[model samples]
Target: MAELSADAAWNYVYCQGWNRDLQRFVGLLDSDTACARNEAGEQYSVTLLRGGVPRVVIDIAWSAHYLGVWTLDEALRRDSHVDYRRLRAEQLFPVRERVWRYAEGQRDGDDDVWEQEVSRKANGWMSTSKRPRGRLGGSSRTAGQEDDTDIWREVPVFGDWRWALPDKEAGPVGTAAEHTGEYEAVSAGSPWRPPTPYRNLYLDDLMLEGATVLMEGAQPRVVAHRLRGMVDMPTGQVITCEPRWLDYSEPFTDTIEPGRYEVHDVLLTDPDSESDWWPRAGFLLRVSEAPVVSWEMALRAGEDPRTLSDGDFYGFSGSQGCFVDAEPLRTADHQINADRGREQSYALRKWARMAKRGELHEHPHSQWSDALERGLDDRDGIRLPGTNFNMIAYNCYYPDGSYPTWIGRATDGAIVCFLTDMRTTHPVIATDH
Candidate 1:
């Protein structure tokens, strides 16, 4: 059993399209190789059986291309004995092309037929000498530097854990033999007692180590969502301009970090309105040079939260948890208006220091957290793209103890909302005065 280090640079693959049902990337096909190798081309699907039952079946071709598996040996010079460079070079589809093919494949509901088509294309290319090359061409140098800036923005802090593990005993937060749902419920005790700061909360479950299933025969759903606030390359725009999904239900709820919220659980507009729309959350940047602090160590050090950096620490009140905003608890204009009050500001300031205090907590709610934002519901909430899960956005409490309203989509994964008071409604639904 080899452990891919927590900092492994290339653990993700860019797929054809986002899978609405599975909440993962639908791997783009390598039709060229499928045609060239015949039975050997089936190297993409490597099935491992347990007691003759297919316990694990991973797509090796997809893994090699997406996770930079081919470059690992040449660049890192570590996994030298094995090579997947050939398969990586054979990936011919770009994001748009892949999206269309995957969409058609799903719409027709014919996986085998699509596979055959891909194989046929590859075979035809051999005779015509017209093989398609992906946006990242054939050179190993170009392949190594494939357009990952967008990929990184889409997923900054990825780990091996599933969004929600099926087994209650081996859950993300605990491994008790007979588990109690303490983490799931709002605590009856003081909300200030946050969950213990963890180091790689997803690493405990060994199954999360690879794109494949764990040794225990558990095939969990992959927990893959783009980080919010990513800058879209072509548009030269930050991704926050678009709305995303937020789910606060059972399966998704199980995945939430104790003091954090995911994009799927939030909504920007009221779903029941006649004209349904989703809007992206707003962000305000207030830069500070204060040293970062971690929550676990800060608690032990007995340091004042007010003295810590903005947007650094986390605190809990009963079952609710929130990270302090980088800015003081002021309205968007940065005014210390008495109307917004003081306790919330103090709370926000205290939580902001957790990052520098030596706690192994995620620095969410900031642009620096990841190439894209995932765990940020604080800086006007992070915007996650292409999610299918939904949540009722009637009104949920912000970590600052304020209840904000959200709007949701019925079919797709888009949500929009306003954090503070605002009068402008959705333009599509707004009646002419």
Candidate 2:
């Protein structure tokens, strides 16, 4: 075994159980009475005891990016007094007024309708709540943000921000074909196993053969569609979007070269119910010709990807299909609003045409209405007037959920592409070397 550094030894003692080497290391501090004990719970605690009394405690919680140290008194007080429910309630109290204003406008004085609308909106907000977990604390202080309170001083972990030991040997990294056998074997008995006649789509295949044109009523277990326009990455910063939405989308902190890239939409054709449409499985934005050899989560500025919990993602909000584009979608507010107005007008015109042609009633009970709301013309892609940016939208899996984007890199660490994982099909094996 290699000799551990002081920080490594300390982390080993707190994260793993104490061994002879760790015990000897701890002896240097105070051999007589100093000892450490691990107490695992929803939050793992490592208590440092002196004369059988807890003096210091180290805590590591699920999804927490750092290890926290607290005095025994501080830990006891927090554990006994902090009420997450009360905190959550306080946090959401201010949202009621805003929700009411919007709901009231839509309700038109119907108390039941108003209440129901409020409840629905409130519940939706609660479901996607980004409240901090594990401990009661303020956010880290930034230029315009409040400073974090000194409840528990945080310490960064040594290796990966995941706070776990690094893998001894790196996993294999290659194209989809090289890993398909392993993926099939692992997914054979899993819930996410692909159905019979399933086909896995790839960027190379799509670019070479063009999108698989679907006939009306034709359903393939898996399919891919080429987004009709090129994405402009003028500043290299990228953001995802649901083309139909007029809202501004936030960009990921990381960037690629300032250039244009091709976009592709991947989807699962079979829906959970007959009324629903095919939902998004993932997206591919080819950034370079280099083959991807590894992947990492695409996070916003100052956000650490390793701290994200399972099922958690860092992507744009979606109600319809989503696309990728460069930041500063429009240069001026007037231009942005004008583009939005045009989309709205286009949608209204299309709906009117469909209604006049008797096409609206064809899928009356189906979720195809959602697609109509996005405008039929935007099904392939949409380029804003007087702008180089283009949006390639597609239906989201079931219409809504937070999807995560992964940065695919070449063996030499150059970015090859970006993938927005909607189905959670990819394996977690990428390592930082």
Q: Which candidate has the top score in TM-score? A: 2
- Model 1 agreement with the true structure over 1-433: per-residue lDDT tens digits: 1221233321222122222223222332233433332334322322111212111222333322321111111111111111112222333221111111222213323332121101111112211111123222331221112332322112111223222122322222211111111111121221111111112112111111122211113323222222232211121111111111111111111011112232222123332456443332211111122221211111212222222221223222221222222112112112212223667676466556764675424432332223123444333342222222111111223322321111212223222111111112122111112
Q: What TM-score does candidate 1 get on C-alpha atoms? A: 0.17
| lDDT, model 2, position 340 | 45
Q: Over the stretch 334-427, how does candidate 2's per-residue lDDT look in tens digits? A: 3434424548788567667877897865432222235335543364455543465555555566457656677778899988877776643332
Q: Report, for all candidates in order, the number of backbone clashes.
A: 39, 1
Superposed by TM-score, candidate 1 places the C-alpha of residue 367 at a distance from the truth, in angstroms, of 26
Off by over 4 Å in 2: 1-45, 49-57, 60-65, 69-145, 149-229, 244-247, 267-279, 306-311, 336-380, 386-388, 424-433
TM-score for each model: 0.17, 0.46
Q: Which window of 10 residues has the lowest lDDT sum in candidate 2?
A: 78-87
- RMSD in order of candidates: 26.7, 17.6
Residue 277 lDDT in model 1? 39
